[model samples]
Target: AVTALRLISPSTALRNLGAATGIAGFIVASLILIFYAIVAGWMIAFCLSSVANLLGMSDFAAWLTSFGLWRNILFMLIFITFTIGIISAGVKDGIERWSARLMPALLITLFLLVAYVLTLDGASEGLKVFLLPDFERALSPKLIIAALGAAFFSLSLGVGTMLIYGSYISDDENLPVVGGLVTLVDISIAVLAGFLVLPAMYVALHNGVEIFTPTGALISEDTLIFTVLPELFATMGTAGIVVSFTFFFLMGIAALTSSISMLEVPVAYVIEEHGLKRKTAVSAIGGIIAVASSTILLNFENLFGLVVAFTTRYSQPVLGFMFCIYAGWVWHRDTLLQELRKGNPDVEQGLFWKIWPWYVKLVCPVIILGIFAQSLWG
Candidate 1:
């Protein structure tokens, strides 16, 4: 009953709507992992390629980074196996333990990479371009939609991921404070990543790599990791090999951490709803997703972008809107206030306690709907 499907009112209509939303969320999470696993696998492959480069295996390293169905399948399986292995150990031993370790490691590596990237010759230029806002493009509908999608995806909102995680939290914890901390951390890492990537791109250009197309737009925005950064690393000699390995290793950690949560959304549903054991549920669900990843890989030219767009752009926002509606209109305010008062007795006096309920009920849904409508029509 802790699942998103069971989080709403007991009324037949509301319950049915909750079920539909939860199921939609599950599908969205699964679809996201399908392409996500492929990209995560690329991170691992790039890590290994760095190792191969260190060992002077030039041909093998190139093959690792090259596009091939078998390569994608092999690495994707490896990444999924790692995910399944962790999830099989259960939440405390698997998800929590690995996340606690991997996240700190990720931050450390990111800081180090950013520090080194800032020392490069063209980094300041990239920083200028990154920090200075272009007011002309600020109001672009495409930009607004893209930013909305990125924020939703980054926070894992509307997909029941936070809902599932929330089910595991202790009643003694302050939900608002925890949510605030999470938002802050997610934003911080995103900014840090921009620091590393944008500056590093300029550094690549400084090294004579083509970072811009003839029209002045960024070249290979989709493949920037595979092309631009690698070229920048190649110019660094021995240090590049180590930096490359660390960078990709950081990326692999990021992918694995995110994949764990995505897998958990469905795994929790199966174990609680269908009475399957954890290991059995993990293996079954993960295997099915692996098959989906393979299907995407085989039809990479067509399915990859389609799945990404469908899940993140369309499905996620709509599902998110439904969640807002549920939290705002269906759930009784008195019960919500009582729940919030669990950890903080004076929660009613707080700004969040005052604003959140109405905001979530009215403003949040309207904004989500408007943004979604704009995405479709504008």
Candidate 2:
């Protein structure tokens, strides 16, 4: 009966589904945070650590001890300048061009290391532990939630990032195909990152050193990739030096790409909403982010938690909900389907029109809101 209703009134069903999703509130919050602050903190942290290490710091902890607050402030300025310069150029000219050049090199380096790991003596054991899910092991509700969040977050979905990128896409581009490809690429990178990190960890364990567990660190997964992976690479002998260079080099690129998207959000907002020129808008936004980042670096404390908590609990989920609403509801289903069908003229409108409404309206929004509430309360 429900299937008949969906088939009979596909467009209306989709609209009703989108309305039921309840994503309108959270999506607005995400847009604001993305345009303003979340990505800036991550960029600030990346630049300070990357630049300092490139200059041969003994350790990040020791570098912090020696460099003090002003050095990080300086780092923030450099980071903002670098970010704004690239973002102001627009995505095709800036992001796509640089990514085209850099990503291939990064991938080749990572592949070599993965090949080496596969050939390692105890690699089979490490691979099994990572790839095979063991049901017997106690599954914490928290870890399951985290994994799901990571899956969505890491894909760069639920935010307007994909939508903004989509806007730049040519009419010839296949929407569904391109979206699926991007999702696959992002997931592959995350899994490859795990492969690169985990085998080296077990190698350390075998050699009688303490292995770091996910629960052992206060830092996020990205930080662990940046900071700790260098030490892991050091375990490999003469090849270690090359691996270290590749690891940090690849990491720097990943950090920069994500940061560029973040900076573009505000720069594009100003350009669209206000009549400001691109260069001028970039400068203003960059300066604000640099100042805010410097403040965070100088006084890392409870405020960090507060900012992060607010963004995660309210901002991210809201933005995600908003994106679905915008794409699913606000944008006419016929219009969206028309766009989707543009490059792929032979594509059928059967299930897409039916499932899409529920997905955008009722399903995704509720799941995201629930995740946010759970994060905040639990």
**TM-score of candidate 1 against the unseen true structure:** 0.96
Q: Candidate 2 — worst ten consecutive residues by lDDT sum?
A: 1-10
lDDT of 2 by residue, 1-378 (tens): 112112323487564544333233223323333333433334345434545555666487345424356655655465566667777776778878866876787678778778876776666667877889877553766565556565655655554455456667899887777877987888788788778667765664555445556677423444454445445545665465555555556655665666666666556656665779888987887776666665666565645566656655555665576565555555656766676677777555556555667787888777777667667775
Off by over 4 Å in 2: 1-68, 119-122, 136-144, 212-223, 226-230, 233-238
lDDT of 1 by residue, 104-129 (tens): 99999999999999998999999999
RMSD of 1: 1.5
Alpha carbon deviation, residue 369, candidate 2 (Å):
2.4
Q: Report lDDT per candidate.
A: 0.90, 0.59
Identify the leading candidate in terms of lDDT.
1
Per-residue lDDT, model 2, residue 231, is 53
